[model samples]
Target: MKYDVAVLGAGMVGVCVAIHLLQQGRSVLLMDRNDAGEETSYGNAGLLQQEAVRPYEFPHEPSVLLPAAFNLRLDVRYHLTALPKLIQPLWSYFRHCSPRRYESIAQEYGHIINMTLACHQELISAAGAEQLIRKVGWISLYRTAKGRHKGLRTLDAYTRQGVNFKVLNGDELAEIEPAIKGHHAGGVHWQDPWIAGHPGQLVKAYTNLFKQLGGVFVQGDAGSLKRSHQQSWQLRDHQDTLLEVDEIVIALGPWSAEITARFGYRPPMFFKRGYHMHYQYPAGQPRLTRAVQDSEKGYMMTPMDAGLRICTGAELGLRDTPSTPVQIDRAEAIARKLIPLGERLDAEPWRGARPCIPDMKPIIGPLPGAPGLWCAFGHGHQGFTMGPATGKLLAAMMTGQTTDIDMSGFRAERFKKP
Candidate 1:
């Protein structure tokens, strides 16, 4: 089979890319080893994070790093065995977190993030997935006065960036989210981001929309991709059939680095593994109306179609490492105090990796020196939020049209050669 473009990954980013390209009248094939949205795309906090103007940065303070060093907190944990491999990237991450560099990165990041809602809305409306979304926005809850004060300081920065929010005191928070039993000091109601009721379902809807638009999706090993004699890309499918395309896009999320490395390009890439599990609501307890993140505890409890999902903080570990759900366990213990969590819905927690770069920006353009090739990944925590926007940007670039946002900071050549 032949196609105009082959998108290797069926997560939100890859699916959206194929949709946009198909909209451009391109014959596209979207392939993934697993089902669509069942990996990293499936297990997010389900937030569209329109207010997340800034990328997550490494904390340099002694108070923050000291706990992380001992792994005493749930928000950040690292595998000792993974340290040697992570040092270079983490050091780069640290250097980029310096106030000056971080501010500049945030400005560029905000440019793309500002378009997230509109981009996703365009696809969601076309795909009939609006029912899966809630525009009530998510909240960041602080448990103590000190934490609340710190949160307010952070809000000042976001406010300056023109992000909309509401400051809620303990009483106001209780009135808004009567289901929550905690006596929180205060909360930041980020009033722009939307929440996904069922993230996986939304992705499926988008994929279905792609199919309806005449795009094909198949199960295949991206590792099977090779350069064809016709100077196109080819990959063998699960049925052992060859598929060829004039152009290829690697949007494989955390595994994207594997394919880029095969082509002799090493972008500074790493993964932050996280875990999530759902729990039923206790009898007589009201359900949470909005997704809430325990800002200090490093977990987010979002009401989902299945139940209330509790997602954990970052775990610095190898991509294929065995699951260490220590953060989930700790989160659950703390969550029970804030809300009445019922029986565990899943037998085990779902684990996925967030693809990250040291500078905390996605690499979203043609691979340097590689013609007929494009790449999009390294979204970190905002993959679900930024996918559609980046997809539109990638499609624009692929079609030789003016991009929706500036792509200077996200180029693959930004990193020093590895």
Candidate 2:
């Protein structure tokens, strides 16, 4: 039987597409290669900032990649065998980091960030997962004057973009988080309507809700797409199983590059691996109510139902070895810098790859070749934060409804070579 829409990749975004499509009275089928949300979506900082103004490609991010080559912990690294495959993405990264290009991308991202938190909350209510979410604002701490200066610049961008924030001094920070120890130069207290639950739990809840709302969950890996004479899509599964649908949505995250190629569109993208360390504190230890980012170290500590999590930005080349003890050790060192008792916490680190594009904005529009196919991936670090928002927008496009926000910037064809 042909379905209305078949969404590939059952991660946060994929499942969200399922739920949104179902809500619109469409016959949706969601599929994934593995258990839902176990990959990148399940483990992340889980921040949702409605007022986020700064884009991922800050002015220094592109140039930092080159200098980061020497310091594996700071930038992308590759195994000797993987060097050939890593060159193109590495160069493209630096190219996008220029101020002229980064500013343009940031402008587009600013609009997206404006709606992220609200969309997450709508999903939270739709899934009845409010107990799993927390509206606590985010705090970014700076241990150095340079980091503080960077925060000021970020604040300037936020101000220009009209994002809300409360600049806090060290003493004010102490009053809010007394357990936090360290002489912070200063901090930016920004309110982000973020979730503090198991992201995996939220994904499962969405999937379950979709199924109950009359959606089908297909368990297969989509191999390629064959266009039918009627202009529909026939998806070839791993075991040669056939599934045909009226429309197809490619919400596949990291693997989107592989899938889109069959449709004659080669996205300019790569994988940037990030790490998260989770550990339970002593029963009496103070628990943080909000998330904190140590700006200088490029890491964040988030409070979740599971435990306090310390996640770091360790971008490795696609061929780099899986995270090593030393890589996690670097995260531990940064954790100690932010949390004085990090040594006592004894957190164990978990690592995963985040799908990234050069411009650092999510690709969330139509597929290039197949008329009925759509693309919704490349969210990178903000996949969890942007998943629901992207899904709602994609659903609008698929059904020919108007989107609340301007979506011309997120077109998948934007990165296509002329």
State which candidate has the highest TM-score: 1
| Window of ten residues with lowest summed lDDT in model 2 | 339-348
TM-scores for every candidate against the unseen true structure: 0.99, 0.90
Residue pairs in collision within model 2: none
What TM-score, to 2 decimals, does candidate 2 have?
0.90
lDDT of 2 by residue, 1-418 (tens): 6789999999988988888888888999888887788888887887776755555652345456455655644323445455587677667776776878777777878777777777777777777888877888888887767778767775776778877788878887777876577667778888655655677887887787788789988778766667877778887655667778998888888888788888789887777777777756546656667888777666777887777777767555562365554555676665654554333243446667788887788899888756888898998878887778888888888888999888888898787777
Worst 10 residues of 1 by lDDT: 409-418
Instruction: Score each candidate by Cα lDDT.
Output: 0.92, 0.75
Look at candidate 1 and tell me the lDDT of residue 235.
Answer: 94
- The clash count for each model shown is 0, 0
Off by over 4 Å in 1: 416-418
Superposition TM-score, candidate 1 onto the true structure = 0.99
The digit string of per-residue lDDT tens for model 1 on 52-128 reads 89999999889899999999989989999999999999999999999999999999999999999999999999998
